[model samples]
Target: MKKLLKNIKLVLFFAGLVLVVFLANCGLTPLTIEVPSVVNANEVATFILNCGTEPRIANTDPPYTSKLIVGFMVPKSWKAAQNTTVELISSEKGNSTLVLIPSAEKEAASGLAWPDAAKKRFGIGPNLLDDFEWLVYRSVPAYTFINNEDIKFKVKISSKVGSENSFSRLGFFILSAKENLRPEDTDYTKYAFSNNFSVTNGEGDLVDYVNPQLAKVEPVKSLDNDFISLNFDAGIIETTLSNTDEIFLEARGFTKSGQQIAITTKVDKTRLKPLGGKKYRIDIWPRGLLNVPQNETLDRFEYYFTNAAGNAKVGYGNTADPFRYTFKCP
Candidate 1:
């Protein structure tokens, strides 16, 4: 009996050590959910879901692993659909209508080439504004099918007003996939596939950096020039550090017909010496009229300047200001 007890103790000790190492390793790896970058308005942005460091057995009996399910979040103003369309009416008592029907061949050409419709049956067309959802459960197979695969969808914009004033607001959605889940999973009982996304009107993703706010925008002069001299500042609230971070400043004319130009964007922080106590000055113009546009029809000009200093891995949000200049058409 004494020998048997010693053997049991040895087995338990070794098992505990193995379990601890496994858990510790899992915690050290970074897990992330990244949405695709090319998604446009009225388009479906596919999601890349990664399980933790390694796939672990989520269920013991049937032998299941972690997988993802997606959900959609849309603007309150829009709905999903089979095909999207618009009706155009002019004040001149003339009206025209356009219809959109889904075509596998047509949709496939939107991006890089797609596989010649495998044996899988193609899904039917969706209403342009109809909000409908379905699921692709048993994600191990689904994941394998879509591994490195990009899913595509479209958004349709129409105008009752002329196309000039008619515009569409694109939406950003959050996609969540249930993983490390169990048959009796109750923690996320209300969870579903990717569906919840916020909406916006712009050229970039719907992910808006809200908290690390832009406190102020200013134009300061740091030098005397024969042409135009300008400086700008931006105040950033508390934030983290990030990679591929760029300071984006944009100047737009009220009229699309007006010409707008951008000067060189690269600014060296080391050269940007400190000004006042909490402020720093960046050289906006070396000399001349800047990289101003040729046309004098510009109604407005704006700029965004960004740089990365200190710890960049975590992303930092510092304050900044923009400089601008306006001139009469020659």
Candidate 2:
């Protein structure tokens, strides 16, 4: 018995219980959220989360101090963790820089990384697409909530957006350090979403996460070394290809050294694969399709759809002008 007791490790269950109880009494409520509806890509945009914590009577002298764990749901392409910075201003704790949580820490409830766990719980919020990630951070030192006094906090997020002209619903999460994202203790956690945040000044095709599109380029941004796909749905609008039994891609790739290469000859190589419902797509290697020299770089591609015989053509928005796709990946 003595040997067993010596080998056994001791745990402080009471301290843990006290912290949980204190969190149950305190509540985080959002007063206002300020985030721009539209911002240029690669520019620093500011988001302010204004909230207040409810007052609660202290069970112990220290009142169960805790550090704030905050998370933001953003586009994966933005690489927010590396491109963003966070600051916290509180009525109680003064000012402090919010530090990113270590990547190795697992969420207590989900047994996954903090960012992945957040995605599993709240998801992509109100956005229609699923190409976003959660970036989590925590406040330095700990905060001690005072009894009978509401504590207010302002979290400022400065992030440099990615180089994609896309829109998404940004999400914000707040909770105490020990609370995490516990399923049973969900009430202690708080979250809010922005309304269709958009990026206007970006390169290549517009990636709208808010709605379904009729035409799109696979790998929205790519270079000559990448395999590209042009996808279109003829039924979405009345076009020359909408009535044609067979559709073909008519494209001209421009080389950096001022050379025009045409990939549209209405041959077997240019035919689009039909996916029923008037949907069609064709995959192509930019370098191979244009027969471009490795020494030369591609500038962009002007393209359109054609009938089987190559007479009728459909361009941007069913206009006579050809649709253009720029090779603008960095």
Give the worst 10-residue stretch by lDDT in candidate 2. Answer: 5-14
Taking the tens digit of each residue's C-alpha lDDT, what string does model 2 give over 205-324?
676776655566777668888998888778878876767768888888899899988876877778888988888988989888878987898999888889978888888777887777
Q: Give candidates' CA RMSD values in order.
A: 19.3, 8.8
Query: Candidate 1: how large is its RMSD?
Result: 19.3
Residues 58-170 of candidate 1 have per-residue lDDT tens digits of: 23464322323222222222333332232322232133432322223221322311111110111112212212222122222222211212222121122111111112222
Model 2, C-alpha of 277: deviation from truth (Å)? 5.5
Candidate with maximal TM-score: 2
Best candidate (score: lDDT):
2
Model 1 lDDT, residue 325, Cα: 34
